[model samples]
Each structure stands twice: as structure tokens, then as C-alpha cells.
Target: MKILYAKDFNRVLDFLTINLDGVTLAFSTAENDRSFNRHKDYGINNLNSIVKDFNINNIKYLNQIHSDEVLVYRNDFENITDKEGDALITSEKECAIGVFTADCVPIIIVDDKNKVIAAIHSGWKGTYNSIVTRTLEKMIDEFNIDIVNTKIFIGPHIRQCCYEVSEDLKEKFIDKTNIDRDILFKGRNLSLEECILKDVREFGIKEDNIYSLDLCTHCEEDIKLFSYRKSVGTYGRLFSFAFIK
Candidate 1:
């Protein structure tokens, strides 16, 4: 697997593309010429352009309520509206699944043997609920995926260097994971990435199969990545996509 930062249309837009066997995965950054402010309708054009550029015939996204809800997609499923969930799983080819995030973690999971792919949105609330583990378990139960052969990609997000939480929130993770207080609480903050990785490992995903972009959205001032904590009401979401080719 290789992680690449790419530009298109004469370097007018920037994207993070992950290259894995039989799959092409990507995510847009705030630097893209088109805005991704989902509340306004303008971002739809950018999203459409991306779909066209990637030649994706069908795409599934979510309402993303920060819950652990998982939406499974099949070619036969009728499209009424985008499902309200934090994760999307699909094995169909030519169809892409994506999720939007600013500071939250955007994760992509792929089962190479089964051609199953999943896109997950894990905010602090979702992480506390073990959204990643739930999504993997759903794949195992529904698709009969082998965790040892699956590849997990953790995209750019606010890292521990910049992600600070209140004492109550810190204690919540500690109580839930039973991790040592000193290790869970680093400096004045808790590390969501560490917690999520722990959960993924617990779900039987090999440590070597996991990869992290390690880019901190909030700390990288030079990059035009979105950060809700940094930009507050003005930030737009970054789009993360995954599909089987």
C-alpha cells in the first residue's frame, strides 16, 4: 500500500490518494478549488466533478449522525436517500463509498480477498462507542471477511498533539478501556487515534496491516485541510472516498 498526495486540473485542487491492490481510495482537502460546505448546495458540484473525474458510476454517502450505525450497500439496494449512518460497507464494483469529516477520523477498510470496502467516520463520540470495531465486526458477520487479510487506512485528522479533551472526557476513555490513566492521558489530553487503533487491534486486525497518514489537520497550518476545532463555524468538510475497482 502507498499513500500519495496528488493534484489535478493543473494543481488547482489537492487530494490524498491511497493505492492498494484492486482498489483506489482518495480524499479531498480544503485546498480544492471547489468548496465542500455541505450545508450550502455549491459543494455538490465539486462532489459531482470528483465523481466524474474518478469515473465512479454509483456513490454512497451518509447523513453521519456520529452514531455507530452501519449501512451495507449492494447493487440491488434501491437508492431512496443517503442513509443516516457513520459507516458504509460495500462489495460492488464501480460503486464508491465516502464520508465527510473536518476533525474527525475518516477510516477506510478493505478486504482484498472478498473485494469488500468500508468507509467510516469516527468522531470522538463515535470512537467512544467503538465505531471502528463495530464496522469490522459487521463485515466479518455479513461478508465473512478475514481480518488478517484486511487493510485498514486511517486518514488525516486532528492528532494527539492538538487534540485535547476535558477531564470528564479523558476519564470516560480510561474507564471504558481500562487503560492505565497515565498512558491514556498524555499531557493534558487523550489520544483518540491510539484508542481507535487499540480497538482495531482487539478486533483481530493485524498491526502490520494498519496504516495511518499521521497528518494532523489542526496542526498543519500550511495545508488547507479543514478543522472544525480550528475554523469553527467557517470550516467545510473534507471528503474521503473508497471503492473496489
Candidate 2:
């Protein structure tokens, strides 16, 4: 199964959406999908609007900290927007779990069996710590999932094409991950996509099960996809969510 454009995307807020195997995934475009951002200048919290548009109430979100922390979603989870974590996994149906990103990678994961789904925020730090793999391990522990049958989807983020980094940091990443140096680094620029693929593959996920939207947030400034590297102060974030319908 593939993640395709929703036929009704334009009918709603123009967010990119796709449904497959009884699951619905939605991602925001900076143009029309302005989600909850707390910056007073950008004050972009449209929760009521999102609920009205998507018709999902038990939407779980996180206050990401660029760490390897992952959570198992619960009905009584409190201070959700203030909770500290980088990933969420659940087997629950209809309730959407989401992550916010601005130049950081947003990953949506599903079991090949279609019994579980996950949302992750992987920044440079989170990627270095293998947040994706951690989430997958959590899925295995919580839902008895098989890593080989897992499908991972990568959303828009800074790619090697424009994700230039410091020499020390690049060297550190090169030393931390087992991915090929050439594939992970493009002359000091990092590929969050390749790094994630390497991590997932290490756990036996087949190449066919991995897909990336392949949009470069840093390079898509004109497209207005909320790139923190491309924006001045007071930038907003894009929301990416998924649920098993």
C-alpha cells in the first residue's frame, strides 16, 4: 500500500491526506494548514477549526524536546501539549496522534498488519539518538509488532541538499550512525531521510516498506512549508497526524 493524495483534500483545508488499509494520515502545508503555534506573534492554534475540519476529537499531541523519548498514548494522558516527548504510538482507532515540525523530520509509522500506528518528531538530536528505532521497539513491546513488516513514511524535512551542519556535529553524526558516510553526508550536509532509513533497516524493515514524501523544508521556502532554518524569528510549525480509521 502507498500513501496517496486524498481526493477530498481541496474540500477541506488543503492539507495533504491519504487513506490506506483503514488508516488516515494528514499533513499540513504552510499555506493553508496553519495548526496550533503558541508564539504570540504567530498565535496559530486552530484546534476548534481542526476538529471541525477533520472531525477528530481525541487528537494526541506532544511538546517535543528533540530527545529519544517515546510514549504510549492513553485516554487520560494529561497536559498533552505540555508533555515532553518526541514520539507517540497507539493501536487505538480513530483518535489521531500528531507531531509538530519546522525543518525537523516528521515520521508516520504503521504495522504491515495494520493494527498499530505512530507519529514521531526527529530533529538532528532525535535522529542521532535513533528515535524511530526506539519507537519501533516500543511498538514491538506494546503491540507485539514485527519490525520486518513495518512500514515507515517520512514527511518534509531538511535533506542533504540543504541541511548543512557544523564540522564537529557532522563528524559526530557520522560516528554515531552505521549508515554509509557518503549516503548520510553530502559534504558536511546531513540526510535525515537516509539516516532514518538506515536505522529502520537495521531493525529488518524491508526497503519496499519505507517511503518518503521527499519534500525539503529548508529548500521549500517559496512553498511556505515552515522551515525554521529559512525563517526569521517567530516562525510557526506544521502539524502531521495519522490514525487507523
lDDT of model 2, residue 141: 89
> How high is the lDDT of residue 204 in model 1?
85
In model 1, residue pairs whose N, Cα or C atoms come closer than 3 Å (at least 3 residues apart or on different chains), thus clashing, are none
Local error of candidate 2 at 145, Å?
1.8
lDDT of residue 180 for candidate 1: 73
Mind giving the per-residue lDDT tens digits that candidate 2 earns over 100-217?
8888999999884847999999999999999999999999888898767778888888788989999999889888886788988889888887778878888888878887776788
Q: For candidate 1, lDDT tens digit of each residue in 152-180?
A: 88887988888889888887888898777
Each prediction's Cα RMSD?
2.9, 2.8
Instruction: Give the TM-score of each candidate.
Output: 0.91, 0.89
Q: Candidate 2 versus the native: TM-score?
A: 0.89
* Candidate 2 accuracy as lDDT: 0.79
Decoy 1 TM-score against native? 0.91
* lDDT score, candidate 2, position 115: 72
